[model samples]
Target: MSDELDLLRAADPAPAGEGPWRDRPLDARAERGLNRLLHSRRTRRAGRRLMLRAEAAVLALFAVLAFTFSDAGSSPAVAAPVALVVHDAAPPLSLDALARSAEARARTAGAADGPHRGSHLQSWYMSMESGPDAAPPVTVPEERITRWNADGSGSELVVATDPRHPGRPVIHDDHGRWRTVSDGKVLHRKSYPAGSAAQHGGLTARTKPPTDPEALRAHLAQLYGGADGTSTTPQLLLALSSFRQEWTPGPRETAAIVRMLADADGLRPAGTVIDRLGRRGQAYVYDDPDGPDGASDATRQMVILDPRSGQLLGLEITFTKDQPDFKITAGEVMSYEAWLP
Candidate 1:
């Protein structure tokens, strides 16, 4: 009994550092932990014994049970983790249907170009709320107008603005479109580009895109991937995205691309969302190769679709996990773009 009492005394943990709880008796849970500690210590001090091993097992089991049956009021009630359920009511895959509808529109649609103008205007809206800089991110709600037309010929415009305000944001007015980079103490400016989602594919009066889905898919696969086709989800997504960046698919081509996308792995419907152009569109997410359940550090690519006209409206890239490097929070918009004709 004396030896046991001495062991208990040594295992006492009421006070971690000779404080108020130091001399006090341990709680039920604490007692169990301390008892295990005491036995563990005894095993170390004296050579391992079968009797001691059995006793240690029995004590460990009791400790676990004590934790299991701990009084609800005595300890904080633990909430059962809720598993997030997404896509429960989502529609079945409809890439084929969407493509067919797009092709129908193409049949009745105007020529790829309204009229070959001397110069075509390229207006791109960008939402780059976060970037890879160390400073607090600035929102760039601005449009970039390049002299280059849809046919892709033009000189680069270089405008000089105040370059001193790296930490401050530059905003462009919708009415004026003029931005002030810096004015000594007063400083702000406009924004720049996020990659456009649905581009005219840089197809001009001369370029021809494949109308067959299989051919289109292979063409795009070769364009984005090389001789060895990319079967991975992220690669296919980026490849399709690359096609949209330079070319706005004609109706038939758009339909074929949509059909091919149906079988492409890693793409899943994320439901409807409004594009930057304020158009209602269906949103699809390309989840990371990692498990879908991991919210943190998971990354996704977004493609917005116009179901009625089978047009690809926008594209977005966001993170499910917080990105400290970019000073972005989880679910924060990384970059979004809506294309315009």
Candidate 2:
């Protein structure tokens, strides 16, 4: 086995005796509910839920993870680190206004063609266990780079590192135990052979997303494949996030996405703020009163868009209320994705 896999195998996810929360009791029903929510494909695709399968105490939370690459090391280099910018209390900019501005900008921009060939992303993902033998939540910070050539060849690289705190130990799941590993570890790296059509991007079967606002909406709903033939606000956000993973939408597609989001229920503009990448963007939020599972809503979903180009800069999911069962505090981030151009 490779050194990285060997190290991963040596670590455990639930190290014994980490804290008091580890010994807390959870009934089977709640445990199953939490598990069902966390591992569901829709939620998992957006990094909206923690991937850990241990118990009911788990909730995905956020942290800012930044990385800087060095030419001297075997670890691959990446763009700058990700910084979590707190939502500002600026005047609300209506989604309608933002959408109009985006449409206007798209009209004036030069024509662009074809689906995006790759993506650059930085994110922080968390997994926690609350019951006996459970360890405190482990936050994993990663930088991923993907590229696809016209010939259908592509490569994917994922590295575990947080340059914001150089040399700090990174905790990872080593089997069932939580263990600390060195920073700058290359967790996964692979390249697709040329002329391989099986690894293409965009929605299933189709390689490009429609640019018409209604078409885009239906496109997303169809990809969702729910019984009602429609997507929830959370599901739409997750769908867009998944699309972004494979393709970076150009001005036309971006404008359509902005318009589509404007029409989504409960999403409202909050104000203008500088994104983590040091770009100014309009912020919109959706705080559903009823959580996805129909319980009291405990999370808020936020999307940031570049006002000038109307492109998405990032998406954040955060705790809106404290969950005593999961030991999560209000305002704690659940997960975040910073998409790079």
Candidate 3:
């Protein structure tokens, strides 16, 4: 991408050359001058004379323009930057105000409110290996629903299925980190290794929801490729891992996304229809941007739109990078979805 931009910048046309004689064509004069200079070996003086004439013509033009546009005898000067006294009256945003603003922006941008309405069934799969030889992969599946109460606070009920214990749902928090309540007793408790609790706590304290989908997409794209530059499941797992971060929606950013979607006339219709998946979300795939080698990666972006009001649901990024030899590794899908309270 950077290379392509550099190439475009380099292709700009150069300025036209100036030569002797303000009104006369320079082709005949240059041809005669070149032949004389080459044969007589007097190119330096001849070149200087030609340049002096061109400079004089430029000076004459500048003088004419200056006189014609003069307001007085003084020359025009650039104005200095003026510092204005801005009042410190701007108020800090309250949590309610932020939420309302985000909601309004989402509405204006045509974000549907469906995902927050009905029950949602979400399924996630992840696999990671520490070395070339490691234990078998781990898989997790979940089903959930988004329910809002009269007080505006909401809770999600998640029932996870473990392959080893089929049919028995392992109820857990929306985060999939804690076991859910059953019969008022803590039926399951997740044990963290020493120092893991501090790390998890730190993550919670520092995490803030992203309002910018573009930034989120860029982040997912980077993670999907992995830290060690390996491809495949690592990228996919990284994409899913983003959900752990809280999604704080920003009004202005959401509105901008909506306007782009509403005005997408030149864009080709996605090969796949934008349909609802996992109960109350709509999905659509689009082409990926060209990569470093001026070639488009086998990457496709999936954006989930809110099924209720058609607002942005979430974003999924998938792309493949070339591996050694002629083998091409499969890309992973990473995504972030909005969390409702």
Model 1 TM: 0.49
Tell how far residue 289 is off in model 1, in angstroms. 4.4
- Give the per-residue lDDT of model 3 (tens digit) for 135-228: 2222223444434333334444545433233444443332212233232223222343433322322222123334444444433333221212
For all candidates, the clash counts are 18, 14, 8
* Candidate 3 lDDT for residue 111: 48
Q: Which candidate is the best by TM-score?
A: 2
Candidate 1 lDDT over residue span 1-341, tens digit each: 33333333333322233222112212222332333333233322344575466456545533333212111111111111111123425574366677677777767867752222122111222222223432333333323223325434433222222222334434432221223342222222222233321121222212345777677666654333311243455545545544454455556666666767666776777667655455777777786734122223466667777878666676665557766754556665544555544
Q: State which candidate, 2 or 3, has the greater TM-score.
A: 2
Whole-model lDDT, candidate 1?
0.44
Model 1 segments more than 4 A misplaced = 1-93, 107-133, 144-207, 226-228, 289-297
Clashing pairs in 3: 111-311, 112-309, 112-310, 112-311, 113-309, 114-308, 209-248, 239-334
Name the 10 consecutive residues with the lowest summed lDDT in model 3.
67-76
Q: RMSD to native for every prediction? A: 23.9, 10.7, 29.0
TM-score of 2: 0.69
How do these models rank on lDDT, best leading? 2, 1, 3
Model 3 C-alpha lDDT versus the unseen true structure:
0.32
CA lDDT, candidate 2, residue 52: 44
